[model samples]
Target: MKSLILYDSMGGNTALVAETIEKALGARAMATDLVKVDKDLDIDVFDYDLVFIGSPVIDWLPTKPLMDFVKRKMKAYARQGVVKPSSPLLPGKFGVSFGTFAGPHIGEKEALPMTMWLNSFLEHLGYAALDQWLVVGRHHHNKEINLSGRLGNIEDRPNAADLAVVEHKVGGLVDSLSAWCA
Candidate 1:
């Protein structure tokens, strides 16, 4: 199956997760495209069977570039009249939303809104929601917050162990899909 790892990362946390996902997909022998969300990005999400969208949480929301990409796709889908009421699922198409957050106030709770928002958009476009992954990230800009956050001392997070978990999740997802197809 074809897959796309589309993400936007600030300070490299989310980027590391995205890369791990890409490698896992590769191991599964899926044809996957790894793309970083940018102002000039013009990708067709429908071209892939599975799409993984990720971002780094900024103030409890995804980065503006990734949000903008979603909005642009929504508009384009609307123009084509493909966005229907009740958003029926599109068979064989799936989406996974992932993100990195340094939840200073509420721990991982800070990443929920961002993940749900992205998943809702994918569902609105008829892709079945497969999963949501949230990883702890260090708040690099603020030394105090990084040390004092609810998730304390995450300076080395999204580390090898964290990425191993992500890789395992990806393998399980691919195996599930393979079995479903079989």
Candidate 2:
């Protein structure tokens, strides 16, 4: 099945996560496409069987560019009647939302709001929202700033530990998809 990993990263944390996912899926022989979200990128969300949308949380929400792309795609889906409640959801279509945050908050309190919003948007567009991932990233610009959370002082976040979890999640997702298809 074909997959897509689309992301926006300012400090490169989210990009690393996106690329890691792409690599993991490719290692399993799955065809995957990676795109860095930008004005020049012309993405058709319906072209893929599985999609991973990721971004670094900015001000507790997706970056403006990411939100703009999502809004635009959602509009197109709605125009095509792909987002209507009556349209049957595609059983094989799935989406995962991921985010990196430097906020000191723990657990769901940190990134659930943004990630869940993303998941809901994907579901609205007719894809089953499979899962969400939240990884702690370092505050690259300045850890001294009060806004930087728990691991803010540390550089290289979404670090080794965070990446291991991402890798494991990808493996599990791939295995589950294989089983479902089989």
Which parts of model 1 have CA positions greater than 4 angstroms off? none
Predicted structure with the largest TM-score when compared to the true one: 1
Across 66-122, the per-residue lDDT of candidate 1 in tens digits comes to: 999999999999999989899999999999999998877897788899998899989
lDDT of 1: 0.92
Candidate 2's residue-wise lDDT over 133-179, tens digit each? 98877777765632445544546677788887898899999999899
Clashing pairs in 1: none
In terms of lDDT, model 2 sits at 0.83
Off by over 4 Å in 2: 86-88, 104-108, 145-148, 151-153
Q: Distance (Å) between predicted and true CA of 97, model 2? A: 0.3
